[model samples]
Target: DLAVLKSKFRGALVGSLLGDCLGAPFEGELVSSGDKIVIQKYFDKLESPDLKGPIRSYTDDTAMMKSVAKTFIDKPEVDYTYMAKLFVKEYFAEPKRGYGESIVEVFSKLRKRKFEDVYKPAQEQFNGSGSFGNGGGMRVAPVALYFYNNYDAMIDVAKKSTQLTHTHSLGVHGAVFQCIAVSQALACNPKKKIDPEQFCNELKQKMKEVEKENDDGLNLKVEQPYVDKINVIQHFLKAKYNDELDEEIGIVLGNNICAIESVPTALYCFLRSLEEIPTVKTDNIFRRTIQYAITLGGDTDTIACMAGGIAGAYLGEEAINRNMAKQCESYEKTIEMADSLYNAVCGASNRA
Candidate 1:
């Protein structure tokens, strides 16, 4: 039984890396405009060879997520400052692995040893309101597992982590909401599948009060964060412009810049894939999901990564073909990290 849990844990991490690597080489090319036929062609043609490269490494999304998992593994307590320092170090260490412009600026300041000042005028990054990019949401999955037992605590750590670089209301909200969704799914009864609408509604209800409180304190009149999340989820359910193999369905989440757009899109993909598993007649759900991810153009890696986590959660690791899952370059390290993190999570649960 413990082996099953461990294998499932490894599957989650490996699934994430597999998708990240598969889509990293095609980070920005997956965009398709209303040409349904062309979109279908694109999705049908995505190949694993297309993802092969000497530099086909995971991006900031995977790096930060692994760090979050590491933090939970090493310490009995969650340290915000330690996590912030790790985030700064990783961004500065490799500043060119496909970071957004605003994030680039933030990391640039950190590189110049201005880590403390990076957050100073953070509210001015996006039209004087701050960023709403998917960067935050992309890396927030570990927080779901880390704080699964305490929903409020998960929200706090998630907001804190996003605020480290993304101070925008929507950005932080997306991270919090996505993590909550993952946590809920992880803890959800296997017999009772998660209901997409009800999930979004629950998230909206939980986040509305806190978001409103913060907006009131800052004198900023932004709509509730969960509202944006729900909007994305709604889009995911209603918008299916392409086939299961078509890429357009993936990018419909918006250019992956909007956290509201990307996170829910990934969740929707997860839901779609889960629904497809029993009846789709595909032995390669991992391959199908990756192909589906790449056709959705723009922010390919992040979308793929999100979809990977969801698939890993539902399918467990053994369900994925070993060759594809094991093909990851950093296979050993990622699995080790995931195992340690899982043990930490279980240990934490036992103590409680």
Candidate 2:
């Protein structure tokens, strides 16, 4: 049983890294089926033993993901400020990782020791409205995996961890939703078939409770408001993906960096890719998950990274493309960190 969970634990992290690394090159391009083929061809090229030149590099997605993983590894209970320090540490170690604009200010403010408040800058962003970007969601898988046994802890800890860099309820809710998705996925019996219908409904119910508690002025009457977005994902999951489906999903579900738009969309991509989609030819569900997410085009790296984390939790490393994974910077290191995180969780479980 531990072995299965371990594989899934590793899968969740590795999937996040692979998606980030592979999806980084085409981050902002508006891609089509033709563009999807180009991405598929790039993967085909990875099968070669002697590949030449710059492999696609991971951006802030993988960097902060590692921070989150390291946070879980270093502190079993997940200290918010300590986790924030990891984010600050990673940015200063290598500033050229193509971090998003708003996050850079968060990093700089954290670096100065004069101010003891680590979360002040983030709360002050957008003229005190704060950033609602998916930065919090992108790096939250580790939190889910670490707290898989305790849903209440997972929700509270996810919020605290997210608030380290993103204080807005939009940013915080995305992390909460993503963490629960990953947590639920990890708890699933690897041997049992997943019911997409039941899975999405459970998430929506839980998120409904969360959103109702923390009303961020997002009117409940709005169609597909936060919790309702998960319902939309359930809609796409039951249908086969087509050209029209692609366009509609991009419009309604979205594929951008905002936590509001991208988080639920990533969940949709993972769930929909689990079944056969005749339009995309790839049979590797993991690859299909990332491919389909990227095809949507906006915020490719972060969306793929998020989708990959979900799919990986269900599919494990066996579904991943190793050659493609190896192309990413710090590939082995991330994998090792994943394994280490697994050990930490298992050790905690044993103690409990």
Expressed as tens digits, the lDDT of each residue in 39-86 for candidate 1 is: 344333333445332534777777777777776777658765566667
Considering every candidate listed, which one attains the maximal lDDT? 2
lDDT of each: 0.65, 0.83
- The residue ranges of model 2 lying beyond 4 angstroms of the native Cα positions read 47-53, 113-115, 216-224, 349-352
RMSD of each: 4.7, 2.4
Task: For each candidate, give its TM-score against the true structure.
Answer: 0.78, 0.93
Judge candidate 1 against the unseen true structure and give its global Cα lDDT, from 0 to 1: 0.65
